[model samples]
Target: MVCITFMSTTAMAREAPIFLVAHPDVATRGLNTDTARAIFAMRQRTWPSGQAARVFVLNNNDSVHARFAKEHLAVYPHQLQLAWDRMVFSGTGQAPNLVRDQEEMRERVATTPGAIGYLEREYLDDSVQVISME
Candidate 1:
């Protein structure tokens, strides 16, 4: 049992310290990177469980946003912007909600139902639930 516990703990610790967080009301417990990318890219509007997903993000120039895009989503910030722009122009999709900073991101995501956004470990609080990445 001790070995099992240690293994589990170590496994969980291996995840990036940054996280995908959501309003407490969202039904999802976790998401894969592809699903996260799809949501952020505005290709998917709803969660896998059919809940409406209100996506949020920091400014494209924000270091957190850039890191999240590259390290988490395996994409570039400009690529995501271009995709959002193309979708907006073509009438197929809309951009994610933009927050001015991590503080605003925490506030908005904590209050908006079905909302999802990324944040560093330090910004976490009880208002938002961390969505473990699959």
Candidate 2:
């Protein structure tokens, strides 16, 4: 029998915590499983203002988004792709904001009020609300 092991060098190399940054006006913080599921699922498609929700996403190469998606969003990357496709074909809306990395996502969300996204749970800050995963 042959055995194989897979490892991610970036996972080990992430020296700082990942933060899901957002705009300043949002009045929410501290995420639980429910909120996480809602935002990530695109079920809550719009902000209270009626503006469509802007869910930012990190690159698939990033492990942090995967962990958050599986734990809180209840969906994997494949599911996310299917979701994007469904929305696109239906003309309901496109996928959430796609940021090349966490930093870009945070910066984008920070400036955009309708924006919502996830990063490593620990890196969140007061600049934005970290919706609960409950």
Candidate 3:
């Protein structure tokens, strides 16, 4: 029973809710899944308001990165990586900036104009704006 409880708790942690956060200066309040996907995939270069969009991300192997890609962007982390790789190889685009962890993600997104990233709920604060994804 104790082992089962531990496993369940770990699973819950892995599935914790993640929010799409951006620099407070970004004017957009919400984004569709497709637009969000494009931005994270480095296909879209600017926010709806015409501000240049700068995307930040955790390492591809991070659990939070995996969860955000799957749940919010509707793509796997591997698929996103492949898209980024193709862009870089083709010299058409650049990959999102990689942050070390949620703390760094929050700090970068909060400070950089038009920056966007995802964070688990506990890391969210007024320093950034939560952009609803639908």
Candidate 4:
């Protein structure tokens, strides 16, 4: 029963759709789940087209960020934080840029070049273009 419960939780994370969004000017085909995961994990520094990728995220405790992780990246919030901490401490990579909330996420992504972030359908607008998952 415990094993079943753990498996279901992992499966549910993979089953959710995580919508990826980017600044309007960043050019590329839609990203596959692996690439998106790499970017958010701070492993991939550029978009597929070779343009620098400026990754952003809300606070780890934010509900939207939590959903984005479980659904989009299929990782838990603590896992991501640990990954970031490891990278930063080792001088291997920098942590993703952070924003306070969805409102700030929209503003920063809209203005920053090569920016990538996520938002719910309702918070989306003309300022950014949604990047479809491949």
lDDT of each: 0.91, 0.66, 0.93, 0.88
For candidate 2, give the lDDT.
0.66
Candidate 3 residue-wise lDDT, 1-134, digit = tens? 35543456775655569999999999999999999999999999999899999999999899999989998888999999999999999999998999999999999999999999999999999999999986
Per-candidate TM equals 0.86, 0.69, 0.91, 0.85
Candidate number with greatest TM-score: 3
TM-score of 1: 0.86
RMSD in Å for all candidates: 8.5, 4.8, 2.8, 5.7
lDDT by residue for model 2 (23-42), tens: 66665545555555566666
Q: Roughly what TM-score does model 4 have, to 2 decimal places?
A: 0.85
Stretches of candidate 4 off by over 4 Å are 1-18
Angstrom error of the Cα, residue 126, model 3: value is: 1.1
Best by lDDT: 3
Task: Name the TM-score of candidate 3.
Answer: 0.91
- What value of lDDT does candidate 4 attain over all alpha carbons? 0.88
Q: What is the lDDT of residue 60 in candidate 2?
A: 64
